[model samples]
Target: MTESDLIAALEDAGVHVVFLPYPKPGSYWHAHQLIVIDARLSSRWQRCTLAHEAVHAWYGHEGPCAPETEAWVDERAAGLLVTEQAYARAEWLHGPDVHAIADELDVTPWVIEAFQRTLRRVA
Candidate 1:
């Protein structure tokens, strides 16, 4: 989905999105019903961040970061941005290249790496 679509979906679910010049790419402040995404990130990166934060919100994830929580969020974020079908298509067209898959999907290479891992877990 496009950024606008994602924003609309979040708003529809009663979550608020805020763009700010934060040091991190994005954060989910569950207490305030707010999502803060860094304004300086590229559009694709912003989408990925949004997806990650959205997962946190959806799962009602809170408290200090833990290994399992971080891993779960990362996996969900990658799946959201790069679905199984999309990943397969990208791989077929890009020949197993992370950068190329990311380019095709409009997400960062880091996201693509996570996506690759997600694909592996499901295979």
Candidate 2:
């Protein structure tokens, strides 16, 4: 879904989203059902951060997340943001360059990496 769509879905699910100058790109507070995204980030990063934080909220995560939890979140966010068909098309057009593929996919390289990791796990 698009960023606006995701935001609307989160709001519909009782999660409030706000933009502020945060140190991190985004954070999800499960206790408050809130998501705070750093307004200073670029639009693409904001989209990425929103997807990541949304997954945390979807899973009802609380407190600091462990490494495994973070990885799982990234995978889930990547799945939500980037489809396998689109990723394949981008990779075919741009070869193996993460940045180029991400640019084509309209996502961050981190999302591309996470998607790649998910692909590996499935393979």
Each prediction's number of clashing residue pairs: 0, 0
Index of the highest-TM-score prediction: 2
> For candidate 1, lDDT tens digit of each residue in 29-102?
87887899999998888998898888888887775579878877888888777777888898999998899989
Candidate 1 ranges with C-alpha deviation above 4 Å: none
Model 1 lowest lDDT segment of ten: 59-68
Predicted model with the maximum lDDT = 2
Q: Estimate the TM-score for candidate 1.
A: 0.89
Clashes of 1: 0
Alpha-carbon lDDT of model 2: 0.95
Cα miss at 30, model 1 (Å)? 0.8
